[model samples]
Target: SSEVQMPMQSGRDYSLGEYFVEVKVGTPGQPFWLVADTGSEFTWFNCHHHKARNKTRTRHGHGHGHAHGHSHGHSNPCEGVFCPHKSLSFETVTCGSKKCRVDLSELFSLSFCPKPSDPCLYDISYADGSSAKGFFGTDTITVDPQNRKHGALTNLTIGCSKSMQNGVNFNQDTGGILGLGYGKDSFVDKAGRQYGAKFSYCLVDHLSHRDISSYLTLGPHHPAKLLGEIKRTELILFPPFYGVNVVGISIGGQMLKIPHHVWDFTAQGGTIIDSGTTLTGLRLQAYEPVLEALTKPLTKVVRVPGDDFGTLDFCFKSEGFDESVVPRFAFHFTGGARFEPPVKSYIIDVAPQVKCIGIMPIAGNSGASVIGNIMQQNHLWEFDFSQNHVAFAPSTCT
Candidate 1:
């Protein structure tokens, strides 16, 4: 198989605050926008429409001038949804199949299956409190459907979600999620294995014009030679996440006094690279020291309450703020790998003449620290599964 590359668009224009790639699934190929999530393990689509019950409704069968209002269990089947029955190549996975018994054992429960030939069902919940209930199915998937010359993959595993909870945080234009996790059944693993067990992506600046697109590339087509000095680091597997080792963080070349346990994998905390999250989130133990060191020189700048910036604790008037004096920030990783991002990546522009800290502490100081998309902007990141390492380099993403 040859390399496959797809254009990615930032969801900021749609108020979604994530990144998405266009995918074509099923027979005759129906195009849908799917969130490119490395943290998710299963690729699924919204196969059913969510209707608001408990709302007022009217009945006209009585033929009299009367209004009947009540909540009832009535729903339109497959209306404006991804109906698997309509697809010519859709096939449900049996409960006894290898895909359901082994590859999907963690998500498919035996209690949900009464017979060996029953449809494999799955119910999964995300960290953001959103949940989906569905069954497993196989279908054809294509990258650029309009141009059939690229070809399509048949009998690929996918989730056919019947209902979704907590629909408020989702992008209305997005029809589903494309799982890029490290599992055997994940899209990345399947697609990457076809070429050279390698995949790469270069995220453009979040504030760039909509016409300027980022890209998700599969296979071994990364032009590392043109991107300047490439840094390689050992890849740590933390199950469904791409973990990286962080020794310390330095601002202006001065390392802060953060505890070692903050980055220790055994301490229930570590660092992972996630493209789904918008901002960088540091553990509480590591957040305080880093924040203090960054603000020491900002004493002369006007400080405002966090509420003004929404979730960000640090905010300052951008009128007299000089970015040159902000100092340089770098992350020291294992194997002497250092990542130095632009100053504007941390000090973000919000409202007019207002700047706030783009990095924040994780809620409740739990879970692993996340290196999100904002910190990774303007750089090409490559995952070499065959070599057991990850590489990165600066790129214009043109």
Candidate 2:
């Protein structure tokens, strides 16, 4: 099997926004910035509709580690530069096929189909009320391997979204999302079958300067020699999400006395590592004790009054803040993998002199906790699907 590794750079959209990677789609190879999401399964891109009345010409431009361009004065934005009709290698998957009827039925909706011979359409509704409607197709996707060699994967499954609603507020500059989930149609699974089932990424600090960048590699690769001691943990198999068994959490060396059921997967509570989510989320049962333990150590710091930033509940005025006093948090997972995140990862700066706890609490009794991108910063995370293990080490990603 061939080995491939690609260097990915972070996006400049927002500090809390998803990480973006440059990918060339279609035969002629038009570049686009795609959100790198391990929580999703289907890889989709905005498509240019020929019959659509409002058509805007897209001019490609490079900015902030991504190749993206935009145009105004049009009511509806053009899907993107690559049009399926223009791509010679593009092929639409017809409805009623095995891939469309069975495989896709589990991941997407087929309620609006008109005929069996029609293109396999999908309507994906997200938990945040964002939706994308599109037809399934296949085309070429090109990426630059770490060996400095250009490689193109042909006939890859992709969704050419005809319409999207309130999903990430995509403009002409933003193309679409690239799914890296464990589903059969995911890019990670497909590429893993062809190449190797190992991928690793090092995320820079979210508050890092725009010029600083991180890296993402596909296929077999080793961490840089300068990285700290690497830790290995079992990668729990959870569809569409990479889960890890979190046994307990500790603040300042004292473990919180949370219930074991809060970390049980069978009880609808477990921890999942997701790059799409900005902030880490915990169930109410686990969140309360963790928050209490965190706040107890910060008695010296003055709490900001009436400072609420949506999901973030803990806020403080950082006028004369000393970060050295902040308590360190350690997340203990099954197999004895202890993840100790830096204090800066939890106490994030949202505004000038305003810092808040980056983790949020999920309002449900039954749902998986999420280790969001912010919590994973400044660490090298490697996902080994073939071996069913994930490894991490502290690193200065930039």
Candidate 3:
């Protein structure tokens, strides 16, 4: 199968904190900046006719009250939304069809349908408390490859959301979510079934300017420059989540004392690589040590008051600090594979002279940790379902 590629944009310039990719959905292909999420299962779009509440609400997507920093002066932000009727190829899914009954049972429940011919409906509530309810449909979507030859995928299932309530991290300009999770209904799973069970993406730094583009590629096209340096690890199959064996962690080449059960999936803990989440979350056992090691060296910078920094635990004045003052951060996976991201990825620049530690603690005792998009930035990650392994290597993402 030929490679299909799309350029990805960072949301910082738009005052949004997530990363986005322009997708051409439906016939004659309408463009939308869909948030690229690997943690979600179903792909969905916003309906044009629905209206968002005309009030300013603070977002807590990153586990804190972090606003978008800019106001969109409009009465109804959903005015010029995606018009589903305009797409000639769009068709609603039947309530009792095989696609709705078995294939998409995770999203479209059979109990929701009263009659066989009724439209299949879906109501999903995310982990962040945001909700979206809508009917299911199928449409043709165009795929853009670098060679200028456009390919169309037909009868692809999607959710045409009638209402979407804002959550902790959703950008107002985001038309929908591009689901790249492990579920059967996801774009990655469906597209991979026909094209190839291999997909890859290179995420640019979260704070990169709009002009600098990252990329998401679908197929066996691994960049020639990074093949030799790429490291491979087994992907622990946990439905809808890509789990990895995170054995240990290191700070400036010194390994920290994180518990074994914290990394054990069969026990009380495990780690998943999630693109939907904005900040990395570690279990309390892992986070305490990481926080101590990272902060123990910074004696020169003054710590900001806890109340002033929102939910972010450690914020310091960036006046006298450079990248050299912080130790290098790396994640050591099973089989000796270590992923060392740039210092800027974790020590994020939130304001003019304020830098905060981007990692957050997992809320509960579930012992799950998330390696969010910020930590994965500037690295080309490839998921090969056929081989049941994921590969990664540092790259410029040019």
TM-scores for all predictions: 0.85, 0.87, 0.87
Candidate 3 is scored at a TM of 0.87
| Candidate 1 C-alpha lDDT tens digits along 197-240 | 88888877777766767678778785433356889888888878
Report the C-alpha lDDT of model 2 over 1-398, residue by residue, as the tens digit: 36555545555444435677778887767677687777788788888744422234332321212212233334334345457765778888888678888778876947455777778988887654677888898898876533266677778889888778864424345578788778865688767766688888887776665466666677787444336788989999798889998989999888999889888899988899987777798899889998888877677777775345666788888888888887899999888989998998888877778888888888878998899888988898889987899888998876
Instruction: Please list the residue runs of candidate 1 whose C-alpha ends up more than 4 Å from where it truly belongs after superposition.
Output: 49-81, 94-98, 108-110, 114-118, 146-151, 167-169, 223-227, 308-310, 363-366
Model 1, residue 354: what's the lDDT?
A: 86
Clashing pairs for predicted structure model 1, backbone only: none
* Alpha-carbon lDDT, every model: 0.77, 0.76, 0.78
Q: Against the true structure, whose lDDT is highest? A: 3
Pick the winner on TM-score between candidates 1 and 3: 3
lDDT, candidate 3, 1-398, per-residue tens: 57778778788877776788777787767877788888887788886532224435432233122123224443433344666766789888988888778777787444577889887888887776777888889887665633265755678788888777888767445788888888864678777866799988888878889898877888888552452388988888787888899999999999999889898999869999988888888998899899999988887788886456446788889887877878999888897888888898898877879988888887666767999888888889988999998889988776
Q: Lowest-lDDT window of 10 residues in candidate 1?
A: 62-71
Using TM-score as the measure, what is the rank order of every candidate, best first? 2, 3, 1
User: In candidate 1, residue 133 scores what lDDT?
Assistant: 81
Q: Which stretches of candidate 3 lie over 4 Å from their true place?
A: 49-80, 96-98, 108-110, 145-147, 223-228, 306-310
**Model 3, backbone clash pairs (residues 3+ apart or across chains), number:** 1
